[model samples]
Target chain A: MMGNLLEHMGVERDRLHFSWISSAEATKFVDVVKEISDKVRALDTDKKFAKDYTK
Target chain B: MDTCIEKIRTICADLLAKGKVQKVIGFAEGSIPMASRPIAVTSKEDVAKLVFNATCGLNLANYVSDVLPKEGKIAVTAKGCDSRNLVTHMVENQVSRDQLYIIGVPCTGMVDKRKIAALFEDEITDFIEDGDTLTIVSPQKKEKVSKKDVLRHNCRVCTHRNPVVFDVMAAEPVEEQSLDQPFADVDHIAAMDPAARWAHFQELTKNCIRCYACRNACPLCYCPTCFVDESSPQWVGKGQDKTDINTFHFLRAFHCAGRCTDCGACVEACPMGINVRDFTRKLNKDALELFGWEAGLDMEKRPPLDVYSPDDPNDFIK
Candidate 1:
């Protein structure tokens, strides 16, 4: 709902992901983070959102 | 419609006289023609100032969260959508149900002032709506348009015209509008290729001054400090760059995903005449289709985002 709509509106979709991992599933959380990190590493740097990482 | 105004005034006056409420939140005649201002009247004498008409376009629920006293009972005149917001506020714990005396108004529909303004090239001197026909008297010529044609976009396809929750109703509920395709606009946008959809949004948001009128007018946007205003590692830039403007609009709509009532307050409050509600409307359509859930209609059920279902479709989950 969040990024897909924007992706449709020409914003890059590869830069975004939506996942659900509870705090109890720490291993799942680590795996998800690693997967996203590897995915981001594979993609080129996003010049548009590069300035700020307030997360 | 006259009966609606009279009933509102009578109920407000009685609530004030009996000390049932500390204040009555309703619309008073605005200084401009065809405009009504939100007013909180504390005394019976001032209840006479209350009026409800086609011009009462903005949802009063946005004000209820801020103006209503926490301890005292506050009476408010809520149209169908406004009442839904009240239910949402209750469910969200923003306001307690016991402190509210909801005077629900069964709305036929509110006219879009922008539509009327576009219809009459010349200045409109007199505007009147009697049932289905809307008479617009301009200096050049008096034109009559179907009331349905002039209604706010959300109203034309509105399935819920009657208040879902209310202690008392000001008028009898009218026949709810049943549209064959409620998300026709969304479907049209979705049908377009990414480039076309991108161009469409770019055109739509080109003049967005970042006024945040849409944000301010939303009932669900009760956050004390919005992300745009945050200074410590600011999430959204304050400048009007295309990226910033797009970020502000998109993220704001994202935050309101399963929560927006599509009350059209944001659309009505927009000074730039932007069709910002399109973003929220798409979310509304998605929520209905995916979860079989509509916002603010039920007090018993939680918002779609608040609860997770295991059977939820994972089409996008790769």
Candidate 2:
């Protein structure tokens, strides 16, 4: 629900990743991390919700 | 509607006189026109002060928890939306059903005071409703407008015009509106690109003064120590910073996921005229489409967001 709401508010849907992996499945975890990293890298670095106090 | 008020007053008076309830939470005439404030009547005489009108926009459910007596029961006059909120409170354990005597009023939507105000050149001095027509009197002139034309945005799209649960109904149920596009407002924003959607929200909340009126007005926001007040881990800043405003609105709406009934209390309470429902309406649409859930309908069933089941959708999780 949080992911969907964030996406609705204009955040990139790919920025948030949800997964379920057993603790024993180390290889699955690694693959999920790699997939998430690649998706994050593909998107431009725009912190729409981030606060810059310098302003 | 006049008969509805008389019935409500008679019922509340009887309850108070019979010692069935310690107080009756209802709306009374506000100091200004087009604003009926909530009142807690303790005596039979005070029941006459109760009134039900389109100007009574504030939800009575927001007061149920606060006005509830420790040892005695209380009666509340509820509209369709307010009754739904009362159910939300009971489901959340903030209030018990046995301790409440709900006097239900079949709602015929509330008027948008802003819309009526916009039509007048001077301050509105009086408002009179007769059937489907409203007589709005200002210092300059009197204008007759149809009640349907000035209906509150949420009320215009409301599907529940009758109370889901009530001890006694003041009037018979009215016809409920069935809309073809209940979430058209949310879909409009969803159609925008990510950047545009962000900009839309930014502009929507730009006039916010951080007054927290929306939080105070919402029946769902009953946390004893709200996230914003937590200094140790303040979830939102106190100033009117854009990011802080956005964060506050986002977190607040998120907290109401699966719980909000789209009562429009937050929007009614907003002094800046911000349509705070823009955030919650999206969640309401998601809850309906994804979970087939509309909040505050059944007290026995737990909210979808708070429960887990094997049949629950997991497509969002990889």
Candidate 3:
């Protein structure tokens, strides 16, 4: 179910990750989120590329 | 007392002998001096080693998830509190109801060892129970304490004296108590100002070590693939920041809002002095009062959060 959801969201198969975090790993959880956000922002989503893809 | 033991043993033996069940998940005496942990019995001969007493307080229901049986059934011992956990799992569609053989016991509440030890200044060598009165023999002195005084706090207000859902009941069912005072702490928290409440929660969760004891102790948290472990698009980080800790706790509490059975295992398992039960109990009360939903009360009832009705209130959007 999680894999299907990730796929629908256009998440890369290689970039997909899974974890079994507990309440204790709060800091670790936050860092992972931040890292993901950074990676997402770093992706080159130029308008020309977007138009070409749409076309 | 022997009748109860014999009955449990007979059921286990028969199940194992007939290939009805592959393993019997029950409590066994730990090798450590004072620890009594949950153990799985595979053979019929090991059934005799199983013991149920005042000290058998640990909810064995959590072990059901740990030992995943591929095909055959597994027999588990359930007190009133433990049975609720099983119901919670069934309600959430975590486990198939038909796969389990529940041996329900009408609990009179188990003793809290920590509370008992606090009563005596000296070290307790051994303790014996003669009905309600527990005789504690210590190196310094021997003292007899009434069971009422040393009972676990949650047990004092426990309404589920009899198993809510069970296959084979070991004893006669006890009367269920009223839910009059179920949300005393929740009311107390509600009375506080928003700032005060935020401060209180901050203080409580700040001490969390992210041990996952609360998650592990929860019977309903049987997700084979939990959201916290996702890496491809990590939901939560692996750092030790206070904000991250608070978020994890908040998310967890929200996730368990309608599903929590209020078994009090998470609070007990927590090493830090965090009152994890407060939020869970509050959520339980909210579900009951707002939606008229009580979790783990019936096997057939669908989880309150999982299904939505056309008439459901949209107060948040409005």
Best by DockQ: 2
Error of 2 at B139 (Å): 0.8
lDDT of 1 by residue, B204-285 (tens): 9999999999999888899999999999989888877777887898889989888888888898889999989878888888
Candidate 2 segments whose C-alpha is farther than 4 A from its true place? none
TM-score of each: 0.90, 0.98, 0.78
The residue-by-residue lDDT of candidate 2 on B24-108, one tens digit each, is: 9999999988889999999998888898998888989999888888998999999998999999888889999999999999999
| Tens digits of lDDT, candidate 3, B199-220 | 6776787788888888887776
List the TM values for chain B, per candidate.
0.96, 0.99, 0.89
* Per-model fnat list: 0.43, 0.85, 0.00
Give each model's whole-structure lDDT: 0.84, 0.92, 0.71
- Model 2 chain B: weakest 10-residue lDDT segment is B233-242
Model 2 quality (TM-score): 0.98
Order of models, best DockQ first: 2, 1, 3
Interface root-mean-square deviation for each candidate?
2.8, 1.2, 16.9
**Which DockQ value does candidate 3 get?**
0.02
Runs off by more than 4 Å, candidate 3 = A1-55, B1-3, B32-34, B121-123
